[model samples]
Target: MTGFDTFLVADWSAAQGVRRAGKDAIWIALAQDGAVKPARHFSTRLDAEAWIAETIRAEIAAGRRVMAAFDFPFGYPTGVVEIICGAADPLALWDWLAARITDDARGRNNRFAVAEEINALFPGEGPFWGKHNRDAYPGIPYGGRSRTAEVSEKRACDISAKASSSVWQLAFPPTVGGQALMGMPMLSRLRRIQGCAVWPFEAWQEAQAVLTEIWPGLIEPAVRASDDLRDRAQVEGLARALSRLPLAELERMMDIDAPEEGWILGAGHGERLTDLARPNSLRPPPLRNDCFALPAGVDWTPVDTALALLRERLHPVTGTTKSGLFEAEGRILAEDVIARRANPPHPNTAVDGYGFAAASVGEGDAVLPLVQGRAAAGAPFEGPVPRGSALRVLTGADLPAGVDTVVLDEDCSVGDGRVAFRGGVKPGANTRKAGEDAGEGDRVLSAGRKLTAPDLALAAAVGHGTLPIREKLRVAVLSTGDELTEPGDVPGAGGIFDANRPMLLSTLARWGHVPVDLGRIPDDRSAVAAAFDRAGRDADVLLTSGGASAGDEDHVSALLREAGAMQEWRIALKPGRPLALGLWNDIPVFGLPGNPVAAFVCTLIFARPALTVLAGGNWAEPQGFEIPAAFEKRKKPGRREYLRARMRDGCAEVFPSEGSGRVSSLSWGEGLVEIEDGERHIRPGDPVRFIPYGSFGL
Candidate 1:
């Protein structure tokens, strides 16, 4: 028998809360009849599972056999299944997880709690490890074990796939424990769909829709293309490759399946699969480890120098995905969108009046006979408007073959079977030439551009229905301080409501980033450490507001220096002098000042443009204009300063207070008036740089 007619590959995620198309989120790519379709994204497992089931049924209804593959492992190590379910069956283990895992529609789930419960069933820390909150899950361990007398860390297939992380390792890169825990339930639901059969466990030829586990990493080298999202490329590449494999080869790869612990398809046949697939060269490069590293002995950096370093070091850390034109607004382009056809598509009239060869009009006022029929918009006159004869045309009408010039209706007199116009109505006047706006194959939108509504309109006019755009960067926001409490919660005396996290999160959303809330972390060493680990796993970057300074309670910077790569930047800027740049487990972290106003300014001045570059766009320079200052003050030479200000009658007005501690100043002003470095006595009429809030994409 031949192989299945369709292949569907799903990259699963364990992230909580609904998410957009982003790195580490679920992506489903399909290949039908040897053609790979654009991958689809799902924010929650319920949605992904529902879509997968419907797609399988539709394909089967169409009489095409389907093969569905999931990236997570189908089962745990051999003995663990028997210990958890009292049976040597992977399907039984799926049922156990499905029954206990409380995954809501929003993707909030009790997977960690379930892991802890499962650990209680076994002695000396059960198989699952690496919970985000170690204190909350005492039953679960924080690290993996080599082996136990009864259980093994890895199954036999992991060695075949050369996978680095075991099923027991969670919370770290390359780990499969969380994926399997969160995914198995969805897999179980998919297996119950009509005409579905589990691979290796069921007869393949007899099943109309086969569901199996896949390891996209097995062919990672072949799909590691530049400028594309890794998850997107992997699914697209693997689906296309696997759908081409012969049934005999597929069966041979499945020859040594552990029925209790399901085998990854093509686990032992990596060379064969890799050879059949061509590498995809369309993905963004993974973020480099040294992107944030600075040369030794560099300290007390200037604002301009710090920004320059960020621009030089940063690259697009997000992946690319195809979005329909309407959905592409605010998204950065992944690749240049070329025009499929020219704008106007044909020589057309720009005004409603006379159209005739410019040669017929002699450089003087003239009159000409009219053509038999008028061309208005979509309608065109039949024959060429014989050289000397004028054709009456309306706006947007295609010009007759012999016509080259037109006169505006208001500038001409048309009646009595003739049209007359004033002199100096130059050749090609009021006419739109073919391809005037954009020609076929021309780059209408360049890569790294953030798409706007006008851009969408232009793309649609040029025949582009969809655009390739970078996935939104997931930025985790955290706040640290013992004296702060959530806004809605009551604080007895010293506690104040946390503002930085919410403000940062809102700004991130406005700037087209997916904001991940890591919640508040008190000034505790271990708590900060746990939050950092979680941030690494959950977000592309972490933005922390407090505990960035070197005070004893400044655990954020201290831990980063101790455990990960860090660069303490004593930036030469007033109100926001202390800044922390670091990498926590390879994820970039930006630590801003504790003062609300300073954090707001730093995020705009530093993080704003840096994030734009990281999100696959050009280095963003917020638009600023020079306007006369309404207030005067003396300046210092050592650092640049920004005063919360607003425009009043076309002049800049500084706020009453310049203190970074004045949280009210942020809301009191419309924008910031920038004071350049160097001592200066500002006058009321002095030209000052004014940056509106809108310029920062706020």
Candidate 2:
């Protein structure tokens, strides 16, 4: 996966004045390898543009991928592109603006004059609006849309992002019209460099430098909590957030193909971007253990005793590997995964309501003056609300400092900039506290547990990009008997295509192990011995089908016994009565029955859990539920039985045949019905334990 080694985010301004510092100033922040440097302030766009070009050049010289982001709209709405540059291409508009727009070193520009010139091309009023000195540009409307507007108020990306203001609204904190006028030329200038490419308009994956539009409001909670000015904090926070994301996520963010009306990065992933606002929390080392040697025994074992032995003897045999979250699904954790940051990252509102200090409200109905600005998702209120005043807050918006209580919008009556509400609401009601779900350093996932899709989401919410996973266990599988032939090959008379090797190999992969094919061997003792030797050298464990019983053609068992390393046990189980457990050249081997049905059942009931332990996980246990039986059976039992069964109409129905040669029964059934070891009679309504195949990690 390719990723950027350096990140830069700039908060642009359109003010025409001398060099200045503080709010509404040009601030550029740089981040690398999860660490953010102090933001550099610039009083003029010319100076900021020069510094950006120099930084990109230096980083590219050092062979680093660089992502340059700006906090402004990259293009206007749908039809505006065709009208401004007389073409549908967005880059053409950049060229158009670059040729007509002008700016200087002391923070001076002719953006208002350009807006006036563009407004003359439209009909009644503007597709452009809002200026500090609106009277000077009479052609541009002070507020409201044009009667004959060529474009919509907001672009598709802006609508999906729930941005507070349209690109045309320029008189407020969040507007970007004037900034776009001044910034487009800067983009056009930057793209002229040899290796710089504009995203969504040019190929960006292999470029040495990429430039894209960003919206810092997507992670306002992190910025609002900072002690620095809003402009500086937003730039630094966004740069750090982008630098920590994995390569796949960054690719997904820029997957949009908007060449005419360019898109904003992180537009639809608001909660995801917000959760990854901070980095460098912590991850403890992986747990290490190796205990996979079974005791030597040659006795008839009961089913319960065999299972107990496996649980007692098995432990992890694999090491750990670092994997990004995108590729970590179905893999077992090698240790506990800790949270990198608090969930929510800051206290936020759970409802669209009014927020104020709870102590200010008395027993009677309370009326409080409303604050000037409202807090919406991705756009938090700037300062703390007064003790006696209430601030309007939307769902998922961060609560301003000094406010701890909220009253739902429906519960309050509003008029004259004052909200009156019943006074019995509890403190912190309708508000979620910071770190309520999972705090920093909290264990989000445990060792030996297989990761699911929801687990990846939880880990990301706690600010993790990579995870520690156990290395996959390698299990070699082989078959014996000249009667079997590989699939996709010509077989001679009386020869059957091999089924057990393919079935077991597929099962091993689904259970998260690497399956190695050792091919098929004839019923010759020397050939079987050679295959076993090769398997021991190449795999952590070996699984062999057929030739376990003491018969004329049972060469696998004969070779193992001659080596003095085999333990042939007669387990009290139906269809899978004989199980050969032994070691060959120090590598464990499981010899399964030749019948397909028996091999599948034994692999699930015994080998699945054993393989899990050997793959750096804990003992695997399948969850079963008792369901009413739909068939009747009479049994005089000294052994446990697993019948191929499927669920229908809330009852367990077993297959008609119990023969080990009925291979199709494994596919006909959804799971197995376990019958206990006892003399018993079962009727149609009797409860039987049914375990689904999925419960065995199939």
Best model number under TM-score: 1
Looking at candidate 1, the ten consecutive residues that score lowest on lDDT are 272-281
Per-residue lDDT of model 2, residues 281-342, tens digit only: 34322222222223465366777888887787656666565566887888888889898899
Candidate 2 regions exceeding 4 Å error are 1-298, 488-490
Residue 381, model 1: lDDT of: 80
Give the Cα error of residue 630 in candidate 2, in Å: 1.0
User: Ten consecutive residues with minimal summed lDDT in candidate 2?
Assistant: 284-293
Model 1 scores a C-alpha lDDT of 0.83
What lDDT, from 0 to 1, does candidate 2 have? Answer: 0.83
**How good is model 2 by TM-score?**
0.58
Off by over 4 Å in 1: 1-283, 363-365, 411-416, 420-424
Residue-level lDDT of model 1, residues 1-698, one tens digit each, is 33578999999988889988888889999988767898899989888888998999999899888999999888877788778889888888888999988888999989888987888778665777785666777777766653233577777888878887778766877658889999888877778887888887766666889988889877765566325788888888788768656443465666664787788888866644653454434646656666666668877787888899899998888766656566678889989889999997999998778799998778788899988889988787888889899888889999889999988888878789988887887888889989999999999899989888999999999999878777667788989999989989998588999989889988998998768778788999999998887676557788998999899999989988896577788888987967888888777889999889999999999999888888888888989999999998999797999999999999999998898889999998999998888898899999999999999988
- Tell me each candidate's TM-score: 0.62, 0.58
